[model samples]
Target: MSLRIDVAGLRPERVSVAPSPLAELGMALHALAEPGHHPGLQGWVTAVTAGLDPHLADRMCEADFLWRTTFSDLFLPCAGIPGRTALPGATLADELDLLDKLTDEQFVDCALEFICAPGYDLPSAGVVSDPELRRRAFDLAATRGPRQVRFTRRLLDDPPRVRAWLRQFLRDCDEAFFADVWARVRPPLAADARLKTDLLRRKGLAETLTSVSSAVTLDEEAARITVDKLVVGRSATGDGGLLLVPTSLGWPHLMVLHRYGWQPVLHYPVGSPEPAAPPSVEQLALRMTALSHPVRMRICRMLARSAYTTTELAQVHGVSAPEISRHLTLLKKAGLVTTRRRGRYLLHQLDVAVVARLGSDFLEGILR
Candidate 1:
């Protein structure tokens, strides 16, 4: 049967309005996929930590990376592919172009479909608005497998149900898988044992874990696995805070904690608000305002990966240097980006940290 899925129904909550669980997941996964220098992910980690016990949050971050890695490896093989064609050796720009062509609505729909479907099922089949596009999506899914087709259909029918299924699905991931993965990761995590010892000395391991556990009812095995995975052979410091690598998967643990009814104490930077305070409506307005200008937003997205010269930005965006400069100036003023002098040229990079904070604040307001 032929189907035409309206990408509109899959609308994700605006990043500037309220944070959707899906957006949280996306941010987390994005962080796990690209470990360092993604300020957007770091901002998320910081926001989540604001409401969590420092030690527990740290552990959750460690565990989250493992989960994220497994999830990515299992699904979304096309993640590395940049564009519509999925060329054999596509450049990052090519992949980004594919991403760029996708409307926010289309991208969210695909993400919902991906999470809802069983492993590696492509939902592109039912999403094509045109007959030709439908055929191509179908062809791609078919080449992958029957499972992909079936899963995509399920995703098209009801995404929330699929998301619920995923929670349970994660609960059921083999205990051994986590155990083995932990064994592989434990050594490096332990390399800085003194920090762990200091954290324990300050708060005590049991108290820290208990405080965090109160917020989320982790399965006994899951909790044990996490402790074993992260704390084994590690020493704590006097302050009871240890620096643990953060990951996208950690957000789920935070969600799970929130679900269990524990209130975490969030710490924000000097200029930011406390996590407990309602997100300012004005912040949301600012983000929406920022996104309202398509050309400017596009410029922001392009600069997100790396800095670009004014001339280079103009060429990539198909605009004049004067126009590009105008937009860049506005972006800089908004604290959305920064520029540096490079060999008589200016380069720009996305102020991801600011974006993350803006995103977190906006979402928190809406969700509340």
Candidate 2:
């Protein structure tokens, strides 16, 4: 059965600050100036600025770019290189070609090598054919467990190479195969209709469509809105459709929705605001207080990698079981970890989604 819900109406009840008017205006000005930053602001700006003077538009665009630079530095400190200015002389097609080249396999490889080298346990290069590679992959996976090594060794023998190979493979595959592969790779995005709805709700139809159209050329905004209005109960919507929005704030925001078939619904949207929820004072206090203790933080990191019983955690941390349990209690109270009873043993695992939201909130507070 298929189901759907309008996300705009389902927004979390706890109100957080909307992006400030100044921020919005600044973003608009940047969109007019650089054109690149406007990816998120695209259709909305076009819709809003329909009758403005051309020269005034140009000035606003420059201001928009400046704000984009400032906001990015503050909010997305780890954002990849900002692309070249897309101005009057540059066409959207040209900017897109540049974006494609920017995030190509070579660049992705470089990024993986840089960011993942410290945490990477498996060997690099042609590990696909080597028995040693398979052994190491299994050992690494077993030691670190499922959460850390989400993909099988066969799928991740050489992380960078595998990702690149898979990208090309998907490009060549038929729709059915693509859908299967996508499900395996991004089950969270696939399973959660709320993620799609929230994105569309936060970024209205026009802007979402403009950004996505720049990349994949499909009209995802319309499809998503249509689905939102059509899908039935929440449970039924689970099978309704699958739409993959862009991964980041660039030209090709790949928007794919599952509308019964394996075909992808692609789009290019200007930008998307991070989906988040505000932490309660108790939650905030817990996270902040927990960070003050190195032992607790280390325990949190271990839990992030995999679930462990109190005894297992104690063994891994080289501490007594009671000590581990005490820390675990604090973590559980903070909503950073969850516990499930497995016979006589209680297994503890990180609450990743909640942790991510909390982390974002904490950072935003610190930065502000």
Candidate 3:
């Protein structure tokens, strides 16, 4: 599947790279809830999880769905216009203030869109007002997973309360760990934005788009940009243009919010690229040792073809879940495997790019 963004009407001014603390905050929660997805942030995730109180941990679990679906979309730029707001440069408080301004209806409406059809064009609020249409949308969202069903029920029952909960939840997260995280990531995010801005100025938009990630490509003649994604979607930039948000936690995946009633957004990874840095001698040795086990090698081979949960792997390999999980921990620490939330389960997959890069990385390290 691929996403095609019609950039025929897009202006150079329409594209800008900027930091988003709210987005980062949401992603931080996501990283915490689904730590296995972000192997690179394992240290940070472990530290945060270990330091968290039960109340905070419970809070994070309740809001985990926000990340799985899309938290950044909920905080769309004011008026859905890209350059009209200072959101690109806004602080967490500033963004939260904007979020606070969301009326109950608007909040629920936005939530419904994401819950129903994530990664597609967001229907305008008016379109969502149709009773039958809204019911069908909610029905579709409900079928997604138990989390979606529960969230939908709560949202439909009392949007204002849910809204308040969301606000407080984010506040709790900020007080707990996100504030420090924002502080640490802000400088790098700013620098990355500036670097991309410079790249845009020196190179053309096509080159800039391609540089965003290997998954992104631009067709100058077609005046379109295509993102290789799991979801198939297509939309035009329209007059609102595109907002390019750079995030430190957005690695391993790319997000495109091509929606109606808002400017399209492309959230790309920044700061350091994948494999962030070359592996150390000890790290390479560990990786090699991880694959030395026949069972672990077979598991890697299976994951290279498709993602599977620990239970599923156990069933297939005729091993107990506990044993599979133990082996997975070793592989995860070795950076040979990574996991992401698929419905209610964590789906583990082989990090093929990392695996392929191992040989070159080892050679480069030795040569250096």
Candidate 4:
């Protein structure tokens, strides 16, 4: 079913792009646990060395324990999206910190609510009232599927020991697997962030949403973003602004998840699956930013026609010498223009190759 996001009051300034090592780790584990869902990840999963260890790779990360859908929220929470962190970036510690504070009642409430929530994406799905829904859900969860979150069961049955098991299991799993997965995933995640940040700035969310692949669409009239997903449905955001987070792990799919009692997050992959390619997102961002301004665009055009000293370019515009120089410096920094000392001042010449590259293939990459 399709997920509809109400963006009626949304603005580009309200949207932000972020990275999540925790979600990436969850994805890696999910791929391992349910290779059937993500056939594309098979190659990378086979190549990962950390989870190869039999002992450390215990049943903790199995497909059942961390169910691909409903139950996975227990470990990663909020559709496996990590909670907000005061840390510099997404971290395992932050996830653990949030989990550590989960009260017994809170834990049970979350587990039951998600496990019992109607798996209905369409209006056609049968509607069940709240009282009957929870009662039926609890009854079904008692026998519907095997208990996936084993620790949580103990949490309700015998609260004391579950904490220790959970703490140790989480720490050991993070150390043995997530740490390595995050290290490998960070560069691409950073690149994706750069690409989105550039798109958000230059093109704004409408254009940026288009580049996030065809599966995501923005209806400007309705101010809604529709995402095609397996079971995802409509969700309205709260006061917290919509968060757009990119990932390297789920390279091909767009994930629309509720961030647990907070704002909703639209998590999806960056344009390129190949992260090591030249003109990385950050590089592209710098170049695009350098060329974005009206004055800078004029400078590039003027320089393209003929070489000119910073003073000469300044004279044409009749602006301050310092301002013209600033624009010229940005262009040079992006390698879009070259400078050489011609007697007294530097003569800036348009770097035809850089412009052509950015205009053609680089432009396609940005759109991708």
Top-TM-score candidate index:
3
lDDT by residue (244-362, candidate 4, tens digit) is: 76767665445676534444667777644533333544556779899889998888889999999888998998898899988887887777899888788789989987778775445
Give the per-residue lDDT of model 2 (tens digit) for 59-122. Answer: 3332132243322111111112232111110222232233244333223222233112212222
Q: Decide which is better by TM-score, 1 or 2.
A: 2
For each candidate, give its TM-score against the true structure. 0.25, 0.30, 0.69, 0.59
Candidate 3 colliding pairs: none
Cα TM-score of candidate 1: 0.25
Candidate lDDT values, in order: 0.39, 0.40, 0.74, 0.62
Q: Model 2: runs farther than 4 Å from truth?
A: 1-39, 42-277, 281-285, 288-292, 363-368
Q: What's the residue-level lDDT of 300 in candidate 3?
A: 96
Q: Any idea what lDDT model 2 has?
A: 0.40
The prediction achieving the highest lDDT against the true structure is: 3
- How do the residues 182-267 of candidate 1 rate in per-residue lDDT, one tens digit apiece? 34433433332334345446754434333332221123322221221111121111111112121223332221110001111111
